[model samples]
Target: MTDRHELILTCPKGLEGLLLEEARQLGLEDAREQTAAIRGFGALEVAYRLCLWSRLANRVLLVISRFPTTTAETLYEGVRSVDWAEHLEPGGSLAVEFSGRGSGIDNTHFGALKVKDGIVDRLRTASGERPTVDKLNPDLRVHLRLDKGEAVLSLDLSGHSLHQRGYRLQQGAAPLKENLAAAVLIRAGWPRIAAEGGALTDPMCGVGTFLIEGAMIAADIAPNLKRERWGFSAWLGHVPALWHRLHDEAEARAAAGLARPPLWIRGYEADPRLIQPGRNNIERAGLGSWIRIYQGDVATFEPRPDQNQKGLVICNPPYGERLGDEASLLYLYQNLGERLRQACLGWEAGIFTAAPDLGKRMGIRSHKQYAFWNGALPCKLLLIKVELDQFVTDNRTAPPQPNAAPAPVEVARLSEGGQMFANRLQKNLRLLGKWARREGIECYRLYDADMPEYAVAVDLYRDWVHVQEYAPPRSIDPDKAQARLLDALAAIPQALGVPRKKVVVKRRERQSGTRQYERQAAQGQFLEVIEGGVKLLVNLTDYLDTGLFLDHRPLRLRIQREAAGKRFLNLFCYTATATVHAAKGGARSTTSVDLSRTYLDWARRNLSLNGFSDRQRLEQADVMEWLAADRGEYDLIFIDPPTFSNSKRMEGVFDVQRDHAALLDLAMARLAAGGTLYFSNNFRKFELDLSIAERYAVEEISAATLDEDFRRNPKIHRAWRLQAR
Candidate 1:
């Protein structure tokens, strides 16, 4: 009856996939992910339900006009062309919001003013009366965006950023935005994980973001149920009847999906800085009974595996970018890897860190690495693929699907290059470890010679020996490998000469690479922030990702120290660890978004096995579409897109290496200005499109976002801090 209404739910760039999935979950089946927004046809009720439930969006923009216009005069004509009476009451107060990039009228404010002028002039000319302009609060809000010389006029359906989610009373530094947090969980693979008996865990759980998000995902709870109003509700076309129906259906679905197992989402952090905030946020999200929070250390973090399968080990460790010393972070990572390997045997583990060195410490090859923007800092999500006996793989060679954030890490081993160097390095590594062991030094070699290209990396912990990173010749080359192994066995006593029984050698193979952060960095030109919550050493270099992805790092830090009353999204997320960091920060719910199924599997292991959030989860799909169809807004969002990718499903042959302009434009469109978009890109040539919509300001924060090891390629990722104006 009411011309099938169309609305747009804009989300951070690269989060479209999770957003689309959110829409589908909320019964918005027809929902679809766009380049930077989600489009759907629904009644006002559907809009309201979306405002109340979506876990991965920044704002819901209701398109009022889609027209081709090249000049300000053309903009006026178009605005006048629309039936102003249908939206604004004759004398009703109205406000204008504008966004544009590479358009004839680049000034967002000027464009908004022009649109406002058009609406008032038309109303006055027609009825001898016009609506008054109200900047702060208005009965009607008109939103306009100029893109590539084109304009899309829309109504601000959700006046405030959906990230406000009507919760979050208390917060700490750089708390995760609700939508971003939810996106993170989705990227980590939440829906499927919560559907199964798997568990979710956030080791550095801060304010309870990951915890609440986990509960919501497990219970299928709408992320925005507590919100009271949406911009669309105040519009003249607001339909109470349809809105009520959508609300009713959403409620029914939520009620029906309320029960799930190992849904025991928990946030654990020793820092007192996050406890109160975490508690407050949990209550704000109305997840008191379902999720739990604790104050403790990750070192002592020992969680029991579920009877069915081991839980996921999700964590956002300190990259030392905003915290500690980067030169030695490898040692901290070494400890983290050792603990996971020794204590978490049956489970898989997933970690989210801007610093790849920290992930390497976990001693597992990453199967998936996503590029995400934590504000404007280009970063990666390294999904450590842990092999476990439980769980079977799903889907293979599927049709083209969706979009989301940026992530580029090693996808497969580079078998062609550096073979000779690898062999030499491997031989040297084994010899060193064996010499150390035999010499009886109270040390443990963490890596050894196994694969040929990796070239032998070893760690010496307190009492154990781990060896990996060595390249073996091949199946036909067992002799060389065996000779190296035996030589090293003899060398252990030669290096330190303890005893064969005291030495433990582990072989590791290099996997595919989506990114390579092997450059050397400069000295203390960067700052490193390490709270015990982050669990990392102070020195180290040559990490895959920087320590902090300005976009999501704050959320992870907040989870380690603050996530109080919000949901979190980690779009194009690699591991749910950042969500775990949010959980530690006290978030109520978390959704991890990503396209790699292998990473999702690791996400479950990281969460459940490590005793993080058991409810919040992993989602595998293209992030672009996910953001496009999502119905909810989050308090926090972690936007990280990849540098370059070509999959059968997602369109626009993406290459952060090239399309960063459109990429950032899409992400900012969905960000809650007062909210954040920690935009990050590793394209050494990465530069902010200062010309893009001026609605938000970009702050070059590469220095603050960098860790010591990544200094070699200071340009590896350039981070920008963004806030809606």
Candidate 2:
């Protein structure tokens, strides 16, 4: 019944040491590795040549019986002593599949219904007809396993999972399976860069699993050579002249690896709906003239290829498993490490991630990494070689040198409390950089904790420099408040001329519930600042508040000078930057509200970046159930909220000094008569519930909404207004 069988194989769990070195280079015998299989023995034509050449396998099996069960009646007496009328017939159909649990044969669907009732009671006691169970095309699939308590069973010879090689029938929202993209192109060596003729790419390619697994490892094709149907195609120990001599030697080594000369494989894909389904999965893996698929965009991924070729730039990117998707997948892995250091410089990248801290912000470095897993997540890959000394120029994004001057304040390498925090950050950058370039303000708040032993606040945004700190005070000394926060993050990129990766830092503490709207770094690095003249969208390294609020710039320039055709309303609209300054002061309709679907998707990308998303709106509920189911009124309201929130998407526990009188009586019942409202919060022991100044006339505009960069923290927030009288 065998010519030396045993096998096993499996895979995808960090590719069991690259599927035990490609099953001992296909001959298999005594192979080894285990967790995520490999085991091995051979013949039966090396498990039909690892089910037609294993590209990091996923099921090959074969074994047929191993026994020693501990329950389900000794696993139905080891599947009725494995005969099953010589591999399934008596009206053939079969399926099984069982996998691990414990000796008690813990449920894998009742250990696949007791091994399909011991292979239909041993083929209905000598062929009285019984088979029938085909869990989708199964003239006998079988498997079993059990482990530790031992059982094994086997047989599913390469069926539904040879990573399906059925040319991804349209994929994308996280795909990568084709044998984990052929074990990330055989650990990014891409078969010695396609045997030295070198040329591959990917640049975030999605439906093109690493350009059809690097064009079937550069043409030596046969990753399940157009897989038709297997799991031992209709068992009975299938042989058909030894599988037509290994399927006609893998279709003549895939037609002499596609008649040689084509290898410059490409891919691109910024989802123009995954570029015609990745060129229809490279024209169904006949590799449409050696991989191509375009629709570009990793910040202009350019790989014209054939200029003395340099191959291998692979990708997998988007490791952002939800939660604000790493703030734009940290600039899509820094625009794929700046298109591999400006267009594949000495090419050889790889990447593949599950957030190895967003692939170390892809400033590029990985001189080899590996790991792998993808199915139960795990991941990694990395590799890199696009050298310029592995490029990490403080996580890239450099470019600005026109007049190039500001790198001076190395204040003789600080440490006298970092030269008094670099002379109070060069005296608040020469007095808030001349009142933020004479009020054109590109985002301000220069220094806030002003020297309370570098408590920190910093701010800037334009030339980026966020900072924050202020956590200390547990009677200080946690290694002296982490050496005064490493002397104010080494004097904030040299007193702010910037570039310590344009400084970002965090800490601030004392937050609760919606913990200052969570995510402190997925790096989706937003930027674009401006202010009273509209532009907003700040991210500053994914949240702790950067979606603009430089002390609400004089109350969003007094809601863009009393929003013109007034209808505004903003309420806790954290990223609505005062509803884009009340829709750039025109506001005939705005809305905003927010229970934080990550700040209402950063207030719908700051109202679709300024064109004010056609009359704005946003509303991700619970701003007190959308202002008591808003009866639609608003003539400019603002609100702010959050001196404490409970945000399990709310329904209890908001305490801006105990729900500032039912949140200013639900914004004065959506105020329409004499409209007005405003009412801010930042707590600082808030109070204003003076029956809202006797049913609304109030005023205190918190010292005229303190601006010039938060006039020395005027409690940082507190406004008023009201009206409806």
Candidate 3:
């Protein structure tokens, strides 16, 4: 064997540069960057050190031989020329990995077969015995790289991909690979932060990847120190004593580093289940005492005041790809900005996300942005300074426009239009407040675009308020509209005597497809309110619509009055509000169907909150499919679908205006004879198909469905009563 051999260190696609730097630091000479890999020449000790110490590298390959080849026979002969007995013992188990293709080796599987055959034939000829293959846990792992007519066979010194640190036994929905997580921490400057005694916090840490990796870096522990076995362990060329010495040095360094006051590395997760796995990973990594994982949400997480205040806050918040709706993510990003500003001021934050648009919504401008790949999806790591100035918005307020005549009565200090908007809101609250109390309503809409200029809807849930702004027309000047919105938002708190923070504002616009079903925020703030004697959970900040639909109060009441001793069914049951009402009204049994797991979970919580769990089944399935398959009959059924939905789980896009006829027919099939089916939709332009009215007895009861709160917007939703003739 040569004293100094050529080595190749492979890493993730975008981390080649960092790996090159790491190689240079490991005393490898002439290190150069390649596409997704780094190449250099090093002694055997250097190679062994890299295998044990390099955190960013995926695999360390020591070049055995490279030769030109034009056919599979030549490839086989070239591999045969190498002394296989020097690498693999006779009768040992081995695995071969091949990539690329030469002239005759058109596929990787065949190429690997040729290479394996060459090794086996050579070993059999020399020692009268050949090594068996073991892909799962091999004693020898060989890699062959073919390019054009050239072949390079190298021994894989790292047995498995170094990313499999064996620390994480479980992961969350989307987990960052261990090596990738280490690369992120190195790039995020976690090492430097730790050296300075700065704390590390991950508010949205999933399975504690960042926290575990950060602890390893701070404690100067070898990433693979705890690994049981390596590729070199079973190889003939492995020097056991030298490797043992290096391992002992790493163990001693880790012990000394951890003996000091442990770095303040903490992680918070909203999911309690995730927190346990994170703690388990930390413990498995041998840093459980150094890093702490807790159960908490981003909105409620606060940096421990007793610890260091100048630490880094690193998180990879959801980018709305597999989880959450994009529109609702805006609220989440904005709330993250608020949390950083309020709780983590003067700290640096590194946010890794796939959506730059959502990152911009955080309101903090990045000081430096690094490009990365979270698997195939292109992502960015934004480094922002969480200072007070980043939270301040520069919306210059316009002065009040002078009216032709001054009012004789003393007025509050507000702009002219603001005063008028305030007055209009106050008047509506008085009007709706009276009706709400008399009817036992704890939540109701006070205003719905009453003043066209405001173009906002305000609803009250106990003392908390939810305001939704309607996106204005393109013809309106954006600056003017923003000024008016600020004025209205300011006037809301003063007019209603509610704290500014208690009011959550979300922009209401015409949503397309499943965008309406997306999450708006993850505040997890739910308020309980009574409507017609039934208690329900209502979340005003996390979703586009609150859990309970205020406009549906009249319909729910109607269901209660007519649902005695009847089997009830609710299709597209959001939060199962109608089901809860029916169950309370003495319905024999109820089944609610919806497509969203989040909403179904909310529905279960609402049912459990009301002490009505049994006899009421919540089915999380596509309503359209459920209707077609359901053989059970119901005395009364409620069908309320979104205006349009293109959820990927469904068979096809659902357009209420176009699919109402077929939907009603499906619902009608399950309705018993003389049973009633209440069909409703919020599509303003929806027209019931004429063919449906001809087949069944249909009555348009839209007028009677409107309550006092939705009286002004009579078209808030249209309803009908259907029964078989």
Candidate 4:
């Protein structure tokens, strides 16, 4: 064996520089950074030390050979060139991992197979025995990377990803990989903070990844000290004595570190269910003495360390995956900022978030920002010192006077135009409030472009307000429109007697393709509003339209009133609001169809929320395609399709104006004898096909479908009741 061996340390993207620095610090020579990896030359002892110590590396690959290859045969020849007897026994089990794609190797599986065959053939020829493939716990794990017509083959010295750490068996949704968590801590200055004997806290700890990693850093404990298995565990070149020496040293260092006074390390998770699991993980990591986890909400999170010590408040808050989650996440981030200010005034904070825009809304300024990749998603680590200077405050507000009477709370003052808008809102509330209460409607439109200058729709979902600014015509001055929008936004909270946070605002513009269904924000804030005595969930901030169409309130209620003792079908059922109503109306059965799995999942929730899951079917398919194959008869049918939809899920574009006749014809086929089909659309210029009246009894019910809230905009949607002649 050579005294010096080439080493390649692979890490997550954006961690190469940090890994390179770590490798050099660990006594690796000639360390250099590459994309997502660090390369260096080191002795076998140094390689073992790196495997035991590196917290940012995914794998430590000890390069065996690097050769140019342009075809499958060259790739096989390169793998065969490496002496198999030196690395693995002839009868041992091995696993091959191949990455990159080029030089006639376009598939990783095929490339891995070729490499495995090369190794097997060479071993068989040398010793009359070949290693079998064991993917799970192999004696040898070889890796081959094909890049730019070159294959770099290496023996994987670290097995099962060094990040495994043998501690975390159960984790929360979207748990950060341990190495990535370490990188976040390292970049956030956790090592420096720990070296100073400062405390650490993760307010939104999920299964306590941050807490464990932070504790390990503070205690000088090797991350892989407890790991019993490695890629080199059973290799022919495995130096048991050398590894044992390093392992014992790490053990002694850990014991000495633990013998000292433990650092004040704690984690708080909002989920009660994760408390025990987090503690279990801590105990498994042998960090229970230094770390304590408790069930605590971020809003009330406070780090109470001995002797009033200050440390770091670090958290990886949820970067919402679903739309409408951002609305609630906004408040969550705001609360975290508030808690940091109120409790950790002298402390530092490291906030890792994928959504930097939400980080900006925290009302605190970060001193430093580091870019990182959480898997494929780009994220930011915002470092902030929780000082008075870092607290962002409204510049308009005067500073508090010392030893003076408390000033009265100042309300946002509206401009002349804003006051007019506010007055109009107040007047509408007076008239609409009485009607809403009398009709038992909790969700209703308060104002819809009532004042031309405002050109915005204000909707009341119980106590919350949803304001949508309609894109002004191109003829209108953009600046003027924006000013008017700002005025209306300022006036909404005051006029509606709601907190500013409860008001969700969005801009309404013409959308193309699936843009309308795309999330406007990831707030995931759902508000349940009562309409027609059926409980329904509505997300006011996630998508372009709230889950429930306020304009279609009357139509949904009418469905509820007329759906008893019948099989009801709802097409283009975004969230299945109408289906819920129909089910609540005592329908025998209900089926809702839509192409979006997002909405379909929501529809399932709505049905489940309303206790209508039994006999309630939610199908995820193109409505036009589903209608063609559906053989079940429905006594009552309601279809409210988009004016134009070119979703990739569908075969072709659907223009309601052009295809309404065919659409109605197919829907009529599914209508049972004496069944009634209610067709409605929001297209302002939608015209019912004349041929429909000729073959069926058709009555225009556009006026009847308009509720009091939509009375002003009766053109919001047109409805029709059709029955076969």
For each of the candidates, the C-alpha root-mean-square deviation to the true structure, in angstroms, is 25.4, 20.4, 9.0, 8.6
**Candidates by TM-score, descending order:** 4, 3, 1, 2
Q: Give the alpha carbon lDDT tens digit for every residue of 323-431 in model 2.
A: 3332355546655776678778888888888767657656667987988878888888889898788775432222232246543221213356866876777776777
lDDT of 1 by residue, 181-300 (tens): 667666676656777756677767777666777777787677766566667666888877877776777677667766433365666776888898888888877677666777777656
Model 1 RMSD in angstroms: 25.4
lDDT of 3 at 113: 94
lDDT of 3 by residue, 379-441 (tens): 888888887565433333322211223223111234568678888988887788888878878
Which ranges in model 3 have alpha carbons more than 4 Å from their true place?
126-128, 304-309, 319-332, 389-725
In candidate 4, what are the lDDT values of residues 1-725, reduced to their tens digit?
A: 89799999999999998999999999899989999999999999999999999998999999999999999999999899888999888899999999999999899999999999999988884437678999999999999999899899999999888998989988998999999999999988999999998999999999999999999989999999999999999989989999999999999999999889999998998899899889999999998899989888987787957546988888899976643343456667767876877788889999999877667657688999999999999999999999988886443332222233334333434568977998899889889988988898888999999888989899998878887878889999976775677667666655666655788877778877778787877768788777887888988777888888888888898999999999999999999999999999999999999999999999998888877879998899998889999999999999999988998788889899999999899999999999999999988888788888998999999999998899988899999999999
Query: Which candidate gets the maximum TM-score versus the true structure?
Result: 4
Model 4 TM-score? 0.71
Q: What TM-score do all the candidates reach, one by one?
A: 0.53, 0.37, 0.69, 0.71
Off by over 4 Å in 4: 68-78, 101-107, 125-127, 147-150, 395-442, 447-458, 466-681, 688-714, 718-725
Q: How close to the true structure is residue 416 of candidate 2, measured as C-alpha lDDT?
A: 68
> Once superposed on the true structure, which residue ranges of model 2 sit more than 4 Å away at CA?
1-50, 54-84, 88-122, 126-156, 164-175, 178-196, 199-309, 322-433, 436-543, 546-644, 647-703, 709-717, 720-725
Clash count per candidate: 256, 2, 4, 9
Candidate 4's error at 136, in angstroms? 2.3
CA displacement after TM-score superposition, residue 651 of candidate 1 (Å)? 64
